[model samples]
Target chain A: MPRSAHRRPAAGRLRGARGLAGWLFVLPALAFYAVFVLRPIALTLQYSLYDWDGIGPSTWVGAANYGKVFTDPDLFDSLVNAFKLIVFFSAIPVVLGLAIAATIRRIAASRLALVARTVLFLPQVIPLVAAGIAWSWLLASTGVINQLLSLVGLGGVTRAWLGDFATALPAVGMIGAWVLLGLCTLLLLAGMSKIDPALYEAARLDGAGPWREFVSITVPSLRQEIAVCVTVTVIAALASFDIIYIATQGGPGNTTMVPGLQIFYLAFSEREVGTASALAVVLMVLVIACALPIQWFAKDGNK
Target chain B: MARRVRPGRSGAALVIAMGTLAAACAAPGSNSPQPQATGTSAVSKAPACGSAPITMNGYFETGFPLPKALTTEFTKQHPNVTWNVREDQFAVITQNAPRVLADNPPDLMRLPQVSELVKDNLLKNLDGYATAFGWDKWPASQLEQLRLGPGGRPRGEGSLYALGLNMSMTGVFYNKKLAAQIGMTTPPATLAELDEVLAKAKNAGITPIVQFNGGATGGLAFPLQSLMAAYGPTGPINDWIFQKPGATIDTPSNQQAVQHLEKWIKAGYFQKDVNAVDYATMMSRFIDGQGLIMFNGDWESGNLDKQMPGNVGFTLMPPAQQGGKRAAMSAPLAFGIAANAKNADCAAFFLNWVATDKRAREIGVEIGGSRPMGPADAYMPEVAADKVTASTLEAGADIAKDNGAMDFIANATGAIYAKSWTPNLQKLVAGKQTAQGLLTAVQADYARQLEGN
Candidate 1:
């Protein structure tokens, strides 16, 4: 009995040493996360509670900055603009990605399919700032787009895409779509490739059309990828800055103002660091609120 | 697939962390203000720079190229001094000010946010240097623009924190060929005459005014300020800019000025899609003779002289009525010494030399692409080649003599242009709002900004 008890302690010690080794493996990353991520977020949270001009002494205003975030119409408008961007950044990309992925999947082993995928994915590799500048030039009133429209005798329908009050937000959102479509398509294609070909083959043998095969087999397999695409694109859309900054700078009467740009302007330009921090915290909460559900839905797809 | 998802998860985690760090680090209060070490360099003494191996780190705005000759001459005089200069777009300078000034500050930096920098105590007070260097002899109007009150509040009569490298004025630039086509022989002498000229230009199928309202380049704001200067009291306008406790931009004359711009918009005097054009586009359009006139600053004078020499004419925005005092918006390409500068003496020497040195003034006019700080008579030889640049210099000189100059309205606050003026002017041009509505919105924003103080 004494021997068994002593053996139990020895086994426990071995397990404990193994556990310590496991913890040591994770220590570096955890330290990095604590220092870089957690500390900054905590500092941001603390700053949001004050009225800081980014210089001099800061006054602790205590929740007033949060109140400002909730009550300010401009802040709410920025939030609404972000949500509106999701329609372009997430919805349109996923829908178009599915179509592209399905079409390309049929000829996946062909050279033309490879070329098309490469061409479509070109935008993802380009820097967002360069892409923004190119699009701004293309969409300028006297730019090539209008020149083409005039060639087609449709110049009257064209306006400054990024500089008109009514079209600026949608125009910026469309840029987001253009950037995300390729990435989404590639991801969905990866997911579609992993799906058992027998499922589509069976659907086809049962007299299902191509559309039906896509809707049932292709889409069902791509749920996780769609979730991934939605999560990433939604995050990009909400936190968009460089593209919009280079494009319109939220101009034409602040039509394209998003939370990211507003937070930057408030903090850097206006010196209202406190209000900016509050907006930033609110944005993080929003990103979390948005990303968690998509992740959960993505995890559910595995079942 | 797990590999791909793992990278993404880690990427997002880093982004979340980085986003917060970016904000936290940019906050100026993240670090306590370092104790200021004042330099004991007195300009009263003759050139005393020895073989001290003085190193200077300077940051200049992209558009304003630091005069190579100025640095070369300084180096030639002080053979041991070495300069490490960096140039960036003004936006980058403004965005990184907090970080740059908080850590190792450059010896000299272009003051984009003067008020904020002063408030943070990131700038050195130049009173001693100014006194010793005879910078006090410069025009009071010019010197007053650099003066700051306690905590670096702007437009106050206190210790000067910066000095202008050269004068920059915003006025009307007309295409000579287009002006002749419209039967306008000379630049408009009055606001009414300007309107008539615009009408003639429009009838002749030329775009009248090439103004960029898409971004904050003071496209429409300059002309509006000029009109307001014509009718409004200079005291009140200066007070408003100086941020006197009771100052307001909602004066009757100011309202009339904005209303006048609205009328021009209604009359189609500005280019089609005025709000759509940016600064570069408008400048290109005007230079290409697509428009009869451009409302812009003297920064483009060098380019104008280069691109279409003898084709462009320059003049101040004419008075609201005939025989009114000539006025325009004029400030300087201002630079300030950093409080934490290791070589404050070298920085102050540069500022003083730019303002007073003969070769420096010549380079300031010709190579530096800026009007000299001294009167036009000081460097007439340098601008003798470019008529448009000469005309801009003359306009600035006249405005200084008449004491009719005022700072840009956007200068009232760092955020005024981006948050209020540009957007409101765009709204007005789009016909979505009236002049009074614009004033109300701007005043409300201004008050809110002040309340934050």
Candidate 2:
């Protein structure tokens, strides 16, 4: 009993030391969040209740700005387009990533797999605006895309791709998919690597085909990466601004006016800080609604 | 190089601290008293920089070649003035004015459109100082045209705030060959004639017009103003801005003007998706000869001529009806000495020299003119080469005095005007919205904004 009591103080001291180190390591990140993230958000919330013009003293307008923004049909247009992109644009990356990851892990051609990953990730490194500029030229009225389509006897499809309302959002989303391809591939490939290969080997030994083994092993193992990819892509999709701005600036008659673009024009162009801040707040609430449930409960769902 | 000091305005420009009493300085009186505003002969020697160069900050307009060329000439004349120019695509000047005024606003700057500054009390009155400098000789019409104060009243009603660099006149740029190809003897001079041309152009597999209406609805207002001049009466445009007696946007003339724009859109005279083309793309397509005609201003001539590989020509914007009096929108544009400027003397001297001296004429001709105000003498000599631009400027001078030229922010086009008329104008042209439907909505929005303001 005396020896047990003597050991207790040492254990308490060890726990205290670990806790101190953990905080010390995270201190820089915590400081960054306070300065860049928390502070701006707090300031934005305050501004949302005013009729400020990005200058001069703000006048309290109660909830007037919020009411106008919510009732505006233009804001509704942007929100609907954002969801459409998540289903159409964001899903492409997940499917493509899975296929590429499977091929890389199964092919046994290490050099080819390494080269493919490197090339795919190159688009990720291109500055978003520069990348959008490149796409704009490609999809221009007389650019390479039309030329290729013409060769296939699809000349009827030719038009200003980004200028057309029906095709603008889809075309922009496709570019997003192309840009994120590398990041998705790398994440899924990482998950594939972590799955014990012996499970695959055992399945093969029992005369299970490739499809059966992949479903039992790879799919179950990749649930985490899929969640990560969806969450990240959805966030990126919702926050899409630079590409859209540089390309169209939300035109073809407001068809491309995503919420982010709306927020930018409201804050910077029209100088409607109250409305823009409210939009930002609205966006945060939407993102949390979309991402929280899946992350909170589904992290351990796959078994 | 050596620093040069302007004799006349240096004292006024001294950057006294906000705490210092302004009582010692007398407020300058009305500048519209008698002689040339700024002239080379007006340059005097005496005041020099106290210690460091006088610093000037401004929201600079003009892009690429023009800006580069002008800055070179301006810098060569004044070595003591260290200027920092910031470029903005839109009304960045208006947005930045309060910050600049509250926390060390630039000693000198350009505001794209003025009323916002004047309304906010951010500008300085250049009355007595400007008058002493011979700027007072400017005609009564010229002072009123500058709208130095609110309600579109005379500069005499309040303090002089800003001056424009040059005025812009929106005109149509057409392919000389295309007009000839359509077998039209000459370009249309009236709205009905222009319509016939559009119909004929469409029949010939050519787009009738190319516009940046999609890029910014500012262009949309150009045609509307032209219509008021040609189809109905200019009284509504001039007097309605100040809530003056006589006319309003709700008047019959304005409704007719709106109907005319709707007709053009519904008829597909311009491109179908008008909103898709930004200013650059819109002008470039016209310059490329994709469309037979386009509507813009004189400043665009320099821009379009370069983009056009072959040939380009200009004419006054056609009137809305046949045989309508060809009225043109006119306003004042000139340079002014800043009230709080450290080198007020230098700024005044530079502006004065640019206004009247022979050297001013030389510089002004090479560039578009510094004085876009509507007067025969106000034009830069280069306009003499283009008969169309020359005549338009002449016409602009005739009506430049109408209702004191410049309009206010709340009156010209407010948020309601934008929401109701501008966007729907495109849909109307696309044949989606009926003319009456669009105009009714626009009138409602305009009234709402007027009430709110």
Best by lDDT: 1
For residues B117-167, write the lDDT of model 2, one tens digit per residue.
Answer: 444444555554455555556554454444444532323245455554455
Pairs that collide in candidate 1 are none
Best by DockQ: 1
Which runs in model 2 stand beyond 4 Å of their true positions?
A: A1-32, A108-115, A205-214, B1-53, B62-71, B91-97, B127-130, B133-159, B215-221, B238-259, B262-268, B272-274, B304-310, B329-349, B369-422, B442-453
- Native interface contacts retained, candidate 2: 0.11
Quote the B-chain TM-score, candidate 2: 0.75
lDDT accuracy of residue A18 in candidate 1: 49
lDDT of 1 by residue, B141-179 (tens): 777878888766647578788888887888888999988
Off by over 4 Å in 1: A1-21, B1-31, B34-48, B216-218, B374-382
Reference-based TM-score, model 1: 0.91
lDDT of each: 0.80, 0.62
How does the DockQ of candidate 1 come out? 0.33
Interface RMSD over true interface Cα atoms for each candidate: 5.8, 15.2
What TM-score is obtained for chain B in each of the predicted models?
0.89, 0.75
